[model samples]
Target chain A: MIQAALTFAVTCFALALVFNLWHLARAPGVVDRILALDTMVINAIALLNLYGISQGTPVYFEVSMLIAMVGFVSTVAYCRFILRGNIIE
Target chain B: MLEDTTLIAEIVVSVLLVVAGVFGLVGSLGLVKLDDTMRRLHAPTKATTLGIGGVLIASMIYSAVFLDRLSFHELLITVFLFLTAPITANFIAKSYMHRHVDEGDLPPTEGPYGWAVYDAVPEDERPIDTK
Candidate 1:
């Protein structure tokens, strides 16, 4: 049961990654592209977590955490650049 | 008793994983299919966050039950994500507003201050130029 669930989830999130890439490639606006990229980061984090669970190891925990932090910071920075014309003032 | 508990644990974790995947897929689908930018913004912030939360919770439960150890690190990620998700969304919205939204389109704030992105400093409050 656990194995089946893991495989199902891994496939779903992988499909989600593809959807996000499609959005990124043909996004109508810059903000939409950024949003797609942000979502991709999130999906990647989910994928990492699922892999860790299936493997029964805690090794991916810190990696996901770091990716989450970096993704948030980058998203905010991109938005800041668009809003203020500079990332840091 | 031990066998039953293990079965229950596996079942619970499986359900959570499946739920997370569904939410994740739906959220990304929304991102692609939504017609409006603001509407698209609504999708990932809420649904995707829940998806990530589900996976994290499942991880915690799986670790506690199957691995015979309690893991709290996933909780840190959960908390950090909850804290940052809103801020990220806010920044993205603000940027969107800055680029695409017209100040005239929004209803007035009914306060002395204007929207933060568009508000201007009064002459008296301007920083003194030293150069």
Candidate 2:
């Protein structure tokens, strides 16, 4: 039963992944693309969790945590780039 | 070996998982279909906050009830996401406005520290133009 649900979730979030990438493709500006990428990270996290449930492994949870941290940091960096001329400054 | 109560719990987790997926898809769809940048911001904020919560909650329940080991790791992700999403949104909004919007549309500067000039020197840091 839980395996069926995991399959459904993986499919659903895959569709979301396509949408996010499409948005990234046609984004009118940098910020729009950033938003799309940020969302893509979120979707990926969901997929990771669902996969973990499917496999009954605890390791995927750690991967998901690391992805979450990286996503937030990258979003901040992108916004900082736009707000300032350079990322490091 | 499956008990009736465990069956009900499994069903509940499945429902939560499906709900999370649906919310996530809708939010990403909003990003694709929305015509404006500011409007697009609303979509992912809803997705990241609500959708993530549902999925993580399902994870927590599954680990605790099925795996027989109490799990609060999902809570760390949840709390971190909630705190970060708004902050990232704010910075993105500021970046969007700074680049796309006109200066006249921006709010008045509190001092010489113009928000429009965020990349430049602050009000105090700028060399006094003693002209």
Each candidate's interface RMSD (Å, one decimal) is 0.6, 1.2
For candidate 2, what is the DockQ-based docking class? medium
Clashes by residue pair, model 1: none
TM-score of 2: 0.88
> Each model's C-alpha lDDT?
0.92, 0.86
| Stretch of 10 with least lDDT, candidate 2 chain B | B115-124
What's the TM-score of chain B for every model shown? 0.90, 0.80
After superposition, the stretches of candidate 1 with alpha carbons farther than 4 Å from their true spots are B121-131
* DockQ, candidate no. 2: 0.75
Q: Which residue runs of candidate 2 sit more than 4 Å off their true CA positions? A: B107-131
Candidate 2 chain A least-lDDT 10 residues: A1-10
TM-score of each: 0.94, 0.88
Kindly list the per-residue Cα lDDT of model 1 for residues B58-118, writing each as its tens digit.
9999999989989899999989998988998898898889999999999998976788889
